[model samples]
Target: MKRILPLLLTLVMAQPLGAHPHVFIDTGLTLAFGPEGRLQRVKVIWIYDAFYSLLITQDMDLDQDGDGLLNPDEKAQLTGFDMQWVEGFNGDLVITQEGQELALSGPQDVTATFVEGQIVTTHWRDVTQDTAGSGTYEVTPYDASYYTAYEVTLPVEILGADQCRSRIAMPDITADLDALRQELFALDRQAQPEDAGLPNIGAKFADKVVVTCASS
Candidate 1:
């Protein structure tokens, strides 16, 4: 696993400058269910934006020919580069059912590829316990400091779960930003907006995947 840079970790935990997203990713989710209709695992896909991809490739000296595609050797070198999760990192994914958060194992079966000048990665996470039969499960991806923005642009797939259906719930950015600003103002009346310590407002701007299962 690659260890996250210390400066990056600090920025992610406490963004004193303000809560704004610097990197963007198009996220995809695939929920897997066992034969008994219980939730088993989740597959997470991340396609990074072109600017970030360019930075990564340039930093790593990949695609030297400037063709915008990585060869087999370069692809192999890029695999699992983001898997080096620091301690207590959650991979920016949150899964909860009935208002209780679920435990998920660390990333596994990781793969990475560069396509169309973007870095695309996929990994699977096993649910530590059974969680599907009835009720709704909410899967949200977010960075607490709002440094990375994730949008559910790809298709949400339900695999081996005929009794379950999934839908995307888009958040209202304008309203959420307004609420956050008010809260920040309440926190500090004299300090400037940039100087006030920003709260963990990433979830407010996240797109949620709501999974509903028919009761057995």
Candidate 2:
């Protein structure tokens, strides 16, 4: 006789995870600049939601002792698991300078730890080149698919410079959502279901840190 998969397996294979948020994260960013006022790197800190943390802790199977705490081995395993993004993810962090998108290298100094029943990861990424030119710069962190919601939890910081001030601006997504609803309402019933859904406008809901420098 041939082995058979279970009914739940068949259902899950037919309908994979949808484009809805399943995880949430609290993010903090620190902008680092050289002594010459050239932007150098960005440090990111992500704290997983308590419920997600519980899931991660259980999934990793690191707590061999069943002590309700992450052992050293488990900590080591989580140090860079999430930071290691695939070819195109970029960890959902986007930065633009003077209306041009800046290319950032991979993350370095990746680390993870369990704190207050939450998993926290920290890493830093360097820009491909010095972006010291006088212009407006913005940094936004968001997951394009909205599979995870990222919220800014720390005040924006400008390191190694006193002339530049950073302010966090949260984009309003109400208009975008309302527009999408209206579009769906007006869609023809004969149209395919996939053709009448809202667009992936996750970026519209991201919070940005705008950095302004003193005029020369």
Best by lDDT: 1
| Per-model TM values vs. the true structure | 0.84, 0.79
Per-residue lDDT tens digits of candidate 2, residues 178-202? 6754554455433332454545445
lDDT by residue for model 1 (129-207), tens? 6655568889998876556789999989998878789999998758768888566535432333345556556777789
Instruction: Please identify model 1 stretches exceeding 4 Å from their true place.
Output: 1-19, 174-176, 179-197
Question: lDDT scores for all predictions?
Answer: 0.79, 0.71
Q: After aligning candidate 2 to the native by TM-score, how far in Å is the CA of 70 from where it should be?
A: 2.1
**Model 2, position 145: C-alpha lDDT score:** 48
